[model samples]
Target chain A: MPSAPAGTLYRGREGMWSWVAHRVTGVLIFFFLLVHVLDTALVRVSPEAYNAVIGTYQTPIMGLGEIGLVAAIVFHAFNGVRIILVDFWAKGPKYQRTMLWVVVGLFVVTMAGFLPRQLMHVFGGN
Target chain B: MAATVPDLAAPRDPYARRKTTRSNYELYGWIFMRASGALLIVLIFAHLWVNLVSGEGVNAIDFGFVGGKWANPVWQVWDLVMLWLAMIHGTNGVRTIINDYAERDRTRLVLKLFLYLAFTVVVVLGTLVIFTFDPCPTDAAADLLPSFCSSLPG
Candidate 1:
């Protein structure tokens, strides 16, 4: 019979999504980081070699992909800062709701300010 | 005559004082986890789709591919944004787990100290790589290079 587990992994008001996000994103970033470091080593191989690898980035679709990347980065960074404050500082969690709203606000504002420049560049705007 | 505001400053509960000595930090921490996690799902999956699915899949990846992506401001900004968000989210999640698990205050401080150090190293290095990546070196065996090199102005 399918029913809610007696011991819910996420028992609090905070849903499983963020907990899962935090973990998943962490693992993804770590894996990506390894690939990134190795890739950078290509520069030491030769500039042309490096350029060849990088040349694949030039596409409008890829530009769209970049938009998603920024969203991930922004949310993760903001949330990470929040967690750091809560852990190191005793009173950090007191303002959790306020902080959550603030993070969202910041994410939106930052993306709005930044994404357009990306669009213009990808479209070959001056 | 009806009372205008009925002691507007009066406490809601006669038993509870208006100025309690309680701090609401845990409340915020809990909320942050849920909110950030929700946002991470979209960001993470989209990243996967672009890198692993769209176009030539992972095999299409190379110096040229990356160079091509970053050549446009869109991917550059995209990468930059992803770096900042994920780094902060992961760091914060770890910090929370550490606080709950760590007992000694000094121990907590040391753990976080190292965490901050690692975070700094990653963010700085990542930013440098994204902005400063130069795929085309001045002197190299042109034959070994990608086809695009032949087109660059000598």
Candidate 2:
């Protein structure tokens, strides 16, 4: 990949990186939502069928995957708010960089709160 | 002689003016994303809390658990609204992404065709499942059904 020359407008700064991250997370969450709806639709089948599939979600591997999925969701959600502010707030563009950091900060705090609880649920014996 | 100042807002060439036929579809789409996004944060966060973070967490999410939740009209509406809003939000987001990256028109069309197809299938199926869901199927073992199912008059 060719490196960008100096003085480009975007220059891969916080603004560009945040935008890239938002797009990536948005697409990931959308695909997950598709599969989630399909899996949920299985309730129309039989209870046994539904349980059998949802059971897979309880496994350790999928539990870890859930962490990643939730991480993506949390980031996407916070960054989405940032994007809204950037569009609507009078001072948003000026504070866009600060808001990106705020988004990251909130993501860390949210994951911190969620991780241990989820980890215990997955690994802690019933 | 003083130079005459031209109005910046005026068209450079009156004969070159193009007829405007733009609709506000994209504008509405932009507004919808922000609006739906704010609502979805609340909807999905509550959804995750109740389903994944409460009780036994993921392990608590069995068929009966779902049946129990959907048994309430509140949850039913909550889920129905969530389903519609989330699907539309996600579909529009993906559409934007496709429009951005898909250089070829045909590729964008094909991708969006599949995207809309998936959206329709999921939305329709989910709506049906939410409305028509039977907490207790006749053939299912009694233990597998939600507690409320037993109290339900046969």
Candidate 3:
């Protein structure tokens, strides 16, 4: 099998990297959800405040951030299913590496489908 | 005899008793993560499509926009399920992290205590907000209310 470069993260097994990515993505989504809940709750106080807060999200910078959020969520969800298969399926453990590749493929496809439309909306003029 | 020092870097015994108890709790947690993840994809994506991708996109959102959505029972149920599932899934994931990394009993307990506390607060507050939300209130100042609410008979 081909090897990763010496002294690099690539030396780790697919499962290891999957775990690391899962944790990172999970944390990112968690914080994002926290902020999201707080902002949505603002509608109770006043619509003006809620609109003002959401207004900031329409900017170019936030548009880019939305892509990153979507990527993190896709990775986490894909790898999470892989983990479930590994645990539950009779042949799962044997094909975990294959599953990881499948997860990567799906993530790429989904993001590719998403990015163009998102960019048009973001960079598209008012 | 010279004093002997244990090798700190040596591999631990594979057969050693586990520090934490073995239970079906982890099995349940694992299952919950996948189940909630599947649901989140649909819930989250639809939410994004409506709020960010649909006609006029994010700029169209405002108090009235949200009020309009929540006026429908379908959207209300959708938001409620999304809130509960995502919060629980995220909380459990963090709990796993704490269990794996916190070496000390006290540290693990403290961390989990706070984690559960936050989870409780969010879930409780979120559920209340979803179910109890009233866009137009007779008690609220008219200026703060949605324009649609004013159009309704007093």
- Order of candidates by TM-score, top first? 2, 3, 1
lDDT of 1 by residue, B13-128 (tens): 46655896789876876676556555655665576567644555444566556666677798778778767766776677678767866877999999999888877877877788
TM-score of each: 0.52, 0.90, 0.81
lDDT string for model 2 (B35-58, tens) is 999999999999989987887899
Model 3 per-residue lDDT tens digits across residues B1-154: 2467755655764676658767788778877888888889889889988987777676667777888888889999999999999999999989989987787799999999998888888788877877888888676666656678889986
DockQ of each: 0.10, 0.62, 0.30
The predicted structure with the larger DockQ, 2 or 3, is: 2
Over 4 Å off in model 2, which ranges?
A: A1-10, B1-18
Question: Which residue segments of model 3 deviate by more than 4 Å?
Answer: A1-11, B1-23, B137-151
Score each candidate by Cα lDDT. Answer: 0.65, 0.91, 0.84
Error of 3 at B150 (Å): 5.1
What is candidate 1's lDDT per residue for A11-108, written digit by digit as tens?
55543455556566565555455456545556556666565655545467766765666666667667666666666667877876566678779889
Please give the fraction of native interface contacts (Cα pairs under 8 Å between A and B) kept by each candidate.
Answer: 0.15, 0.82, 0.52
Query: Which window of 10 residues has the lowest lDDT sum in candidate 3 chain B?
Result: B1-10
TM-score winner between 1 and 2, please give it. 2
